[model samples]
Target: MAELLKAGAVFFVGFLALYLLIVLVVWLGQERMIFQGHVLPQHYAFSFKADFEEYSIPAADGAILNALLFRSDSSSRGVVLYLHGNRGNLSRWGHMHRPFTQRGYDVLLIDYRGYGKSTGKPTESGLYQDGEAALQWLLQYYEARKIIIYGRSLGSGVAAYLAARNPHQLLILETPYDALTNVIQHQALLPLPGCIFRHHFPTYRYLPAAEGPIYILAGSHDRLIPLYLSKRLQPLIGTPENFKVIQGAGHRNLAAFQAYHFELDRLLLP
Candidate 1:
């Protein structure tokens, strides 16, 4: 009996070690799995009434990022610097073009590194650097204009980091996670201790430092990011009125919610 117990203990230790190794690999390579390219379908394309241009902005690490700039025909009330989710490129945000453009807001949608035509591997810091570079490009090129920063999902962390660094005209985060670590813990169902999770995109940590107005939108049924996470972060926001929860919507379907459309219109419209 004693011998059998000792063998069991050894086997358990070995299994734990192997499990941890697998987790580390998954954590490091999560971006590759999460951010597969989504090619733009020609059927969904729309004609641009105003002058639209594509740009290749250089990141801080010297990576060239692909971006689309949509300018309104008339004087725009403000410009929206859009950081999209992990799955697709700027073209995927084509659905958002008419709504924002019709409101007379210029939108700059960018494809993060490793997504779409941008070069370089996707990492937590790499995305942040890409956002900063995009913001700098907008600031330098579109001077004397109001700028609103908008992000969804993973892009929310990048937007929050930028909001902390610079005073944006406004900050809008949709279906954002509290932190990357929390997201991994919830999704992976890992039993490992918190000390081992290293990728920290702590949007909560930077929220307080944001000097401008912030609008946080979350879905009640968001499977990817739990509603409770957004609920927990809501009180931590600089202003409580900025937070909103979309009813009966999940992470991907929030855009279809009429309340979401109304809130977006209220926030982004002149």
Candidate 2:
């Protein structure tokens, strides 16, 4: 009996040590989990130039978020609220600015919390809050124009949640995962209990509620999120007609795809 109790104690200690180690690693790698690396300053050298304005909008949670507003010289029919991927800031999105501007659509690129010069640490809830704040800012400023929410990678979850609640807006999701739990399960290779993670974005739960003109874009060679995940979301998202899969494109090289630019132009053009 004493030997059995001793063995149990030893097992308990081992389990506790492992749990603590995992917690430490997760805490240390939180920023790394979201942003890939430090975002360098970007200079837009595109042939077409748009009038750019920098703005800082206050979030509902009192965090100040930075954004770049690009307005075309021509008539503006609508605004594109661009929520970028996990890593990098609005500067990384400068490359795509010309396409939208050339199409006569205003582009608003935002930096979520802990991204670029935005304040506060990045949490899943915080990113959602940032998305809401950005949408609200546009509604206040561009009340007459149509608002389109464009999300890429991690931002897809944020855009999904917003679209679910407010169906009047247009939603364009690029290389999005089914849910936060799905991403953690597949990418982190952790067990099912990892669903208890505090930062779970849970986009899958919100898909059924989305009632808008939805557009889905995925890459055939996207190994990170995988093509199957996006394909799985098709039925759940009200059978979207704008689903597109770009050939020869991976997770990181989405910008290299001519199809990406073509789709954006086609979508923005009236």
The lDDT per prediction is 0.80, 0.77
- What would the per-residue lDDT of candidate 2 be over residues 39-134, giving only the tens digit for each residue? 333343222245578888899989888788888778887888888888766666655666667788888888887777677678888898999999
Off by more than 4 A, model 2: 1-31, 35-50, 190-192
Tens digits of per-residue lDDT, candidate 1, 1-270, equal 999999999999998998888688666766655566564432334344555787889998987888888876668877888888878776666456566777788889888887767788777888999999999988986652388898888889999999989867888998998887787667777654666554578999888888778899999999888988777678767788888999999998887889988998898765
Task: At residue 142, give the lDDT of candidate 1.
Answer: 67
Q: Which runs in model 1 stand beyond 4 Å of their true positions?
A: 1-25, 37-51, 143-145
Query: For candidate 2, which ten residues in a row score worst on lDDT?
Result: 39-48
Steric clash pairs (candidate 1): none
User: Using Cα atoms with residue i matched to residue i, what is each candidate's TM-score against the true structure?
Assistant: 0.84, 0.82
Model 1, position 246, has a per-residue lDDT of 93
